[model samples]
Target chain A: MFKELIGKRSAPSKNVIERGAVKKFAEAINDPAPIYIDEKAGKASRYGRNIAPPTFPITLEYGAIEELVLPTKGLIHGEQKFHYKRPLFVGEEVYGVTEIKNYYERTGSFGKMGFLVIERQGTDAQGELIFTEEQIIIINEAARKGMPV
Target chain B: MTAMTEIKVGESLEQMQMPPVTRLDLIKYAGASGDFNPIHTIDEEATNAGLPGIIAHGMWTMGNLAKLFTPYVEDGFIEDYAIRFRNMVFIDDVLTLQAVLYKEEENKREFKVAVVNQKGQEVVNGTVVFRMYEVGMAG
Candidate 1:
């Protein structure tokens, strides 16, 4: 179904991690670690500043690329994996790009479904890879049937 | 305060149970994470989309697992974490999180984690790798 989107890579999008946003995200996730919010604790730690939680980068909204658009009516995330070179620090400007890794169709108890795999790479301002998140999303048959032109 | 001095494979870590997930939590998460996906909040929309009703974000469950390790882990200690959403999570589902020490090497430990609903159904399964500053961080 996403044949044309396979192998397409999105343009690199940049983001600056704000400290307040990191605190809000950590709170939302209900993680109360001092490194994510307490400034005095942050100054005394090894990083010398506030840092984001491990999965914080998942919230970064990179502008969608037209070539990589997929029907989202019934899309649901299936599997996700995160690998990190280091924890992202607040105030660091990072860049990321999304690429369509694979796509396939299979029949299951729920009926025919399409599985799309996407890989996202986050790099620091200096262009070093910080983390990579790979996600697999499944589109049910009903959703696939309603694809837009 | 360190918990352990020696680490062994095939050992069970502490088990934790979380309060039932409520719709209020979902809305708060959406606002904080900036993920306004209706499936996470709007019940009517979720029903229209053929879901069981509003569902919790997969990331929220993953983040809960991370919360279990805050006491023992350094702020940025996670090196790798992966999970598969095995089943859907509905409001009022109380989740139990369990972890087992799967492997150990010099300055590193791997844990296998499972999140199960009250009915003993696995909602999510995953593994996490941690670079330990010292052994026996888990009590």
Candidate 2:
């Protein structure tokens, strides 16, 4: 069912790497690193400014591809990977887009499951590539059956 | 502080013992990450979805793994990270984070990292590649 959606890309979404959001994310994860929260410490650090956590991109909005839809519950985050050219600085603006890389199904202990692979990229205002995130989401039989018709 | 020179392949980084997972943690993470996935924060929703109860977001657990490297910010930053979710983490589960240096290069280091539940079963495992700053290099 998801085969037709392979290679589909979403419209670019704009995201501002806000300081407040960064701080909340950092705290939510229980990481109190000065570079992420303290402005003075950020200035003293090598980056010379507050930077978002490596996984902070999860908080950014990646516009949805109209044809791609999955259940809101029971989907499993099977795997994830991140590659970064540089950390995103607070107050910087970046554009993000997601593409459906592939999709397949397999029978496992949990019964038949669908694996959906998607990749998201973030670019700075100058159009420089900042980071890429690839993830595989597992749709168990129950979740697959619950998908909207 | 661990200097770049002192890091040795085959050595273990200091392990971090995180407090038990809590519902409040998931709630805060949902608000911060904008994931708002009901399975992660609502017990009834999770049960209906076939889960035992509410569970932590995999991203929430993955995000905390970065804490193991915060001490080395001056030496370098994580250039790459990859992981698989081996198991679901439930509220009240105590997680211990550990990493071992597996490869070392002139300007980079690689570590195999894992987060194990209190039972010592790995719930997540992966690798992190840290890119180092050159001697006297400015940020």
Candidate 3:
């Protein structure tokens, strides 16, 4: 099912990485690092402004993969990796795009499954690449086939 | 920042454990990560999807692994982190996150990272690469 998407890229979705969103993300992760939420502490640090947590870019859903839709049910996040040119800062306007990297089928204890690899790239307003997240998602074909759970 | 001179290969960093992965935690993560997939928050939805029950977001589990580095280095110093989700994490499962420095180059250090549930099942496995910077050299 994912065969047609390989090498296909989604349209760029623009976003404003806001401080409030960063705060909510930090709070949700239970990471209370001052640099992520406290502006005073941030200014005193090397970044000179509030920064988002390292994994905060995962929150920019609408900003990436605007047109790439995959089966959501029975899908398991297989693996994830993030490469950063630098820490994403608050108040930055960025755009992200998703590209299908690869796909394959494998058999497991549960049964036959399909693995889909998708990569998301975030770029600043100037179009400089900021960070890229590549994730592998597994689809349980057995479950989708109405086989025994 | 971890003083550039203090880092040594073959040494282990302090191990950290996260609080139990609660159902509420998943809800909070869904809101925070903008990944409100039903399987992560609603048990019935997960059951319908043929899962045991609601599962934690893989990014959340990955973040818990990344959180281990926060105290050792300066804020926002993580250059690269990667993880493979090996097993599903269920509610009430307390995860242990650990990292050990195993390799060193001119300035970069490589650490092996892993997270295990209360029963000692490996939930996540990965590596982190951070190149130490001279104090005041960070941007």
Candidate 4:
């Protein structure tokens, strides 16, 4: 159903990797790693600053595509993958954009399901690639029934 | 710090047993992650959506799964992570994270990772590749 969105890319959105947000995120996950919270530890570490958790990008805002619409309540996050060239420092600005990679339907135990694949890319101010996150959202029959065809 | 030489490809890492999932935990995660999806925090909304009360965000489970590598953070950082949500995680469901070394290289180690509920059913499973710091390198 979302096939028309394939190859569509959104405008770049800005995100600042704030330290307080990083600390809160680290605590929320119950990880007390000093490198993520302690400035001294971070300075001592190779990265020269506090680094964000691997999955911290989930908190960043990605630009939106006008045509992308799905029920937020019933969709399942089926799969996720993140590849980082280097960890994000606590105080850096990243510009991120997302592209609809592919879309398809499958019949699982829950009946007809839709799989929407999107790729988000984050780059530094110089436009250097920092990380890439690919995610698959699963739309069950119930959720798909609510979407616009 | 985990010495690179001591890692064994066939051995399992120490498992992390998390406290039972709580509404407060989900609320805190929702705020921290900027994912305020009500289905993860509101029972009524979840029921209206045909769910069995509130469910945990798959990212929450995925974030917790990365805790398995925290102990080795000083040794290296997680360079790549991939996971599939195998089942829904509900409130009060006790989760445990486990990882077994599946591959070891000169500068990286790979692990087969999983998170299971109290009944031992896998809720999420994936692989993580950790890029190790060169020996004798200062951090």
Candidate 5:
């Protein structure tokens, strides 16, 4: 089941880190944390710069949908984890790369599906590695009543 | 919109890492996700969840990982990325995440990456793919 699936890779993306985008993202998360909106408010917070809510730039960080697309049903939001070195602030130019690491076929309630994982790394304008994420997506196999080894 | 043209393989960029994982961070994540499963807030809830102590949300870690892609060429950024919630990172878990060039040029773009805890345990495992130009998009 894990054999048919192989590997792939991709290039990096860049951003100017528009502070406003970060604000919208914060609102999306409904974070009441002031650091994400007001500079003065941020000064009073741990991170001096207006911060960005985690996962705020994922979709934007990765240029296109195909980068992470693995067609499957019951596409559910599984689980997530976070490790912060420092809070992300608004208006900080950042860049990163996204690549497909691996994949395989597995059986589940929905039947046989392809399980794949993708990773992204965003570094500040100074070229310092900041955030890195690896997302897992499972794509269900298309119906083919009788076709297998 | 052409500015967000596309990103190719081998290109690289960066962003900032969160300050540090804290108990408060977990609580904030809990509020955002509405996953007040308790384990993220109370040690008792964590123990009941079969965890070491108060644990953070798996999604929080994933969200942190996603922030890594914010900086891409104009029409740049992560097309998509995902991971399996493998290990648990506690309050003191200082994390360092990175993705070096694993491989490219395949019909399928792929890269190898990982998130490590202070103890050097791999808390999460996964990959990311980028598309310079989406294969299918309507103007």
Candidate 6:
């Protein structure tokens, strides 16, 4: 079976993190580096200021939710993509937009199945363009169980 | 952690975390994503590839971001979305995720959205267009 739902998400406000905070986050992920923690070290690298890791914004996704809602029984990642305009700095405010894209059904093992795709866009404080991301979550029994990994 | 706020179009999500890169994190991510592609799961393979160390499962990082957007409201469910990997997510790097709305209509039921990373990188650029409940529609 296939099900489709469209969502309207408002744009989030800007956020900023200091140099040390970036380092601590990197440390949480077990990263070992000076640029993430050291200012001069960051200046030496392509990033002029302490740069947040690529996945930094993910840390706050759940914080915006007031309830738990998603197809869980047979949801699996179908795809993902990323694009960028500039590197994030230590103290730049950030923002984003997430939209429920589309879904479809096809033949499968258990029966007919469906899948969903979502998109999110992020920006920085100066109103400079940042990056865009698209992701998929499968809600199909066949795709979740029968499909090859 | 800074005060997390509600998401809406025209606004922006800020201060997402982006940690550094490391080896242990790669292995952990390897276990999480179940894609032990030696380059991401093994130091030997990564180093040989001239990479500083083991990379991470791009999805794992993405998944973590997904978690932040949890409790997918009705509008966050399905329609269609796609993303393309831009750069490698090395282990130990704490990445962040952000999305913005492009289109929305409460009366008819529709919205379009996009996402990006802290480095202003478009980790997975795609769109989401889902239907929604009307102003007085009950659950």
Q: What DockQ number belongs to candidate 1?
A: 0.60
The predictions' CA RMSDs to the true structure, in order, are 3.2, 2.4, 3.0, 2.6, 14.3, 15.7
Best by DockQ: 2
Q: Mind listing the fnat for each candidate? A: 0.70, 0.76, 0.70, 0.77, 0.11, 0.13
TM-score of chain A of each: 0.92, 0.94, 0.90, 0.95, 0.76, 0.70
Q: What DockQ do you compute for every candidate structure?
A: 0.60, 0.67, 0.66, 0.66, 0.07, 0.07
Which pairs, if any, clash in model 1? Answer: B4-B136
Count of backbone clashes, every candidate in sequence: 1, 0, 0, 0, 66, 89
lDDT of 4 by residue, B1-139 (tens): 4454587999888888999999998999999998898989999888877788898989989998898787776678888999999998999899999989989877878999999999989999999998887744343
TM-score of chain A of 1: 0.92
**Interface C-alpha root-mean-square deviation of candidate 6:** 12.7
- Residue lDDT tens for model 1, B1-139: 3342344688756778888999988998898788898999999988877787999999888877776666554532778889999998899999988878888776677899888999999899999887766544454
Label model 2 with its docking quality class: medium
Off by over 4 Å in 6: A1-4, A18-21, A28-31, A62-68, A109-111, A141-149, B1-58, B61-139
Clashing pairs in 3: none
The deviation in Å at residue B128 for candidate 4 is 0.3
lDDT of 3 by residue, A79-112 (tens): 8888888778899988988889998988879778
CA-lDDT, candidates in order: 0.82, 0.90, 0.80, 0.89, 0.56, 0.51
lDDT at position B65, candidate 3: 75
lDDT of 3 by residue, B1-139 (tens): 4543465787767777788888889998888788888888987888987788888888888876777676644522667888898998999998888888888765567889999899999899988887565533333
How well does candidate 2 match the true structure, expressed as C-alpha RMSD?
2.4
Compose the digit string of candidate 2's lDDT tens values, residues A6-68: 999999999999999999999999997998999999999998999989889998988999988
Candidate 4 chain B: 10-residue stretch with minimal lDDT: B130-139
What are the per-residue Cα lDDT tens digits for candidate 4 across A1-149?
Answer: 69999999999999999999999999888886998999999999877889998999989988999999877656778899999888788999999999999999999787898899999999999999999999999888777777532
Off by over 4 Å in 3: A62-68, A143-149, B1-5, B72-76, B135-139
| Model 1's TM-score against the true structure | 0.91
Interface RMSD of 2: 2.0
